[model samples]
Target: MNKPDPIPARLAALKTTPTHDLKKQWRDLFDSEPPPFNRRYLESRLAYRIQELTYGGLKRETVRRLERLGEELDGGDRKKSRVRADRDRPTTGTRLLREWQGVEQVVTVTADGFEWQGRPYRSLSAIARAITGTRWNGWVFFGLKNHRRGA
Candidate 1:
């Protein structure tokens, strides 16, 4: 006869199920990609931190630990990309959109880009479309260069 592991109990107790739909939240935050990004905005705005990583993103070791813990907890869906590290650059204008439906928004993404607001909108039109759908009244565009605030 042995005592039960307190670690399990503590983890179980700490396992707070994500309250807000991650998809929607992720979508909303997705609008802001590239650089000068702040994932914290989304977490603070939503009042929750569904993603396990930290404000500065997760360290490799932490990710592994989390994955291991998750597996032990019967949650083993965390998969790591096998692609090479050097090929992570944005070679073209192609923007990758990662949608999380829970928050009702889109994550306009690119290998080289910047984040504005919590959502990672690539262009004004995309943002407009997000807020007003395809038929809404407005237009948006991104110039090839960055303009100064006064200009």
Candidate 2:
């Protein structure tokens, strides 16, 4: 038998603790400067820390298993898997609105590809080219990537 951790009870009681006391508690638990987040964030993170410290983290085998499952579900080809990455591709059912030559263009995200003007396109770059009649980076044209001022 092992003694139970007292940190969880203390974390639950954080709701009633004063702001100053909460700061001190944060320092004691994290041994670092407390972030400037609200009280709710502090309490939740502290509670998670307490629970993590009380028990142990996940095992290496579990992480590897999850990764293997993800690779299996994604079909395991680098080029094929790139389409599912969230960085540049919009989620399914999302609508992307753009304006070109004073006309508003709407593109809807589908499971397989994007739909624009009653037509299906393989890539946003193709859509951008069709709209502008010139080659352009799709993410830049759609304002997904940041553009620096005075380049």
Tens digits of lDDT, candidate 1, 1-151: 9976554443343335253443355556555432333333334433333333224457899999987987875445433221321143233444434333444333334443423345454344445455546643222133312232213
> Number of clashes in model 1?
19
Query: Which has the greatest TM-score?
Result: 2
Could you tell me every candidate's TM-score relative to the true structure? 0.22, 0.42
In model 2, where is the ten-residue run with the lowest total lDDT?
Answer: 142-151
lDDT of 2 by residue, 96-135 (tens): 8899989998888877677788877666777898899999
Q: Over all chains combined, what TM-score does candidate 1 have? A: 0.22
Q: Against the true structure, what is every candidate's RMSD?
A: 15.4, 15.2
Off by over 4 Å in 1: 17-83, 91-105, 108-151
Q: Name the top lDDT candidate.
A: 2
- What are the lDDT scores of the predictions, listed in order? 0.41, 0.75
What is the lDDT, from 0 to 100, of the residue 46 in candidate 1? 37
Candidate 2 regions off by >4 Å? Answer: 1-80, 83-88, 146-151
